[model samples]
Target: MDLALTAAGASVRAAAALSPRWGAAVALPLFGHVAPPRPVRVDDEPTMWRARRGRLRIPGIDRRGTEVETYEWGSGGRTVVLAHGWDARASQFAPLVRELVAEGHRVVAFDAPAHGASVGRRTYLVDWLDIFSALQERFGSFEAVVGHSFGGLAALVGVAGGIGAQRVVTVAAPADADALLTQFQAGLGYSDAVSVRMRELFASRYFPGERDPFAWLSSVRRPIPAAVPLLIVHDRGDRLVPFAEAERIAAAHPGARILETSGLGHNRILAADVVLDAVLEHIAAPIAAPAAESSAQVADREVVAAA
Candidate 1:
């Protein structure tokens, strides 16, 4: 049995090295082995059904004549916006929304284009940011923004670009687009060159006339206005996004707090009590005053320091 297991592992590694898609194939089974068991969707859950409901309409960022669907619960006071990970709908945050509503906070969540009830055949970062901006505008400034996985990265970009959230929390978030692309390349057994080609292909197919979709991250990490507090929660056991990405985000942003845990993995972190508690604490904390200088000034300093 031991020999067989070893041989199987070797075969998987060989497959990963041979084909880019094989990496995902190999990683999926490992993820199932380590990740916590939970349903990915919770919209139909009884607790989520009890919360108040509202609909939102917002224009797409890059696409013309396109609108996105948004859902809101609770009142406008002390609003919290929740963004779910890739391939997940707004209902995926049902558990968190129920708890937040019980605490007297309003919650707004949306189905990313092509996910849940939202319209579109494909989804991308710009679309996610547009939805975030629209929600911030409609619901008033968000007291807190909590996002999971890819959604977490989107939240950071949106908040950095003036989404009006007082506090930000990311669960198992990749620090930047480059990190995410690297992960994909490693997982898919693709060289850096192939990864670049894949990104070009994705952008061309997804955005058409766009120069590059991946370059958006360069603009995202600019010094955030000092008023917003950022919190990142990641599980060391996560197989999809490495925990080191969270550390990088903390290192990049001054005063960003990172809470690292074990056993939660990627999706399971959503329902992890400890992760949820950290998020609640961060949101409940008092807001910091906006920075005396502009974020661009701070970002320039960061660049110089790195150089």
Candidate 2:
């Protein structure tokens, strides 16, 4: 049981009983908060040792100096940019980074604010976009931009917003920003009144002066250009971000290739052998001949042969 979640649940319920506006105001910050950053795992060590570490100062919400940790592996090859999910660091991409480097592709990844070695307690969706833009300015054009979970949505938004990349891969990612609010409401067992107020607060605070902020950030609403090849890797049994979200993403992009897996759940899907193969194949393929003329769904064990 999560003591913090439980306490938050009680607090929000109490506040909502008083006033939903107050409840939403209280819950907004919790929605942005991440758990403690994960340490480098045993499997991540080998890749970690091979990386050339660096830092980029991405201004925080209040315009304070906040430095995000960056990592690079291999050089003098097609550069592939990687973006990690919320609460996850760049090192989470160690397996994918290793394979890309072995294929002679330069790999770049960054730990978003409030994650990994970065110094912060809370981060918003716009912060992820800012980091991606900063990396693109430094790296120029990317051969591919692969993102996981929240990072996946950011990658799509960034590409749509003009970060050049020939190919894009999204693993176990949500379809839009609204999903974040929905999940937060469900997790804290808040009421619809609170949910409505939270939406108002989120939009006003995160994306001020925008008529339709969620649509602006939605992959379904503003998909990557049809010219760019897309690969959607997801697990059918994922509990964090539902498989339905991946389906919505695939439905939005006609020619997107889908690698549907089971049992790997959310985060573990990142290191799955099959998922890596699909991502690599997508990256190596010619942009002219997308993945499929239409969305193609292949099961985990058969993805390699299908690809």
Candidate 3:
């Protein structure tokens, strides 16, 4: 465990000793906190420098003005939106941006509120939906929506919720938000009592009217339509989100194609040549014909599992 998580766990435990509600009250904000944003890698520099930079003023958790950094590249072929993972920046999709632009795609990407160059301290799942909604109004229907990790979840949710897209891709993303909260609870070594209250508070605080926040934020329960080709790429050895999540997603979306990789773990899989190739191919493929509306498997599948 890292020093920061260790210290946080200790603090939460102490608060739980006083009262589980107290621990939950303390833990909720930390759970939503977005900080120490990852720096733009040296590899991301070239693509970052080439982007047509812009900004979007979207309402945030506090219903105040928030600026979200946006980037665009290429023109005219087809527009693709790249959604980076949590605590990650738009520039992290540099390699994919280059590839898409090379194929004559007008690529659109953004750093969510509280992430990258965007200005905010806390964010939630709904923020992604809001950003996607805002972008759709500007860019019109997307040719494809590609997302990684939490952003991937947002993409699935967005497309499932009727943000038009012919193709959808999710990389190393969990199937739902509830699993992430469970992982966070485990990592913090908090008790079940604290977890229950924490979830209750989280839903009330973030999504007031929602009867079930977890289900509302789920990708599996509300999957992208079968008509839209969905590609799911996940590392078999990923330590953060287990490969089973990929299987679950694939199982839920009958016609989805799933690619399993080795060694790349969580983040590095983004730049893997195989991953990029698969994404490009999936993007370029014609929308699924009636016959193609079945689980179309791809790449090396050691398990021979139905996608």
lDDT of each residue in 1-307, candidate 1, tens digit only:
3464455456555665777456335533332121122343444567555645555555554456466566677774899989887767777777787778778888888777666666666556777788777776777788988988888888888877778888888888887777765664554443554454555655565557867655555323564556677787887778888877876676667667777777767777777667666778888888756556432332211100100
- Highest TM-score: give the candidate number: 3
Model 3: per-residue Cα lDDT over 54-125, one tens digit each: 988788877776878999999984889999888888988898999999999999999998898888888977
Q: What overall lDDT goes with each candidate model?
A: 0.67, 0.86, 0.86
Clashes found in each candidate (C-alpha, N, C closer than 3 A): 0, 0, 0
Clashes of 2: 0
TM-scores for all candidates? 0.74, 0.93, 0.94
Instruction: Sort the predicted structures by lDDT, highest score first.
Output: 3, 2, 1
lDDT of 2 by residue, 151-206 (tens): 99999888988888989999999999888788888889999999999999988887
User: In model 3, where do residues sit more than 4 Å from their true spots?
Assistant: 290-307
Worst 10 residues of 3 by lDDT: 298-307
Position 221, candidate 3: lDDT: 80
Off by over 4 Å in 1: 1-44, 51-55, 58-62, 200-220, 290-307
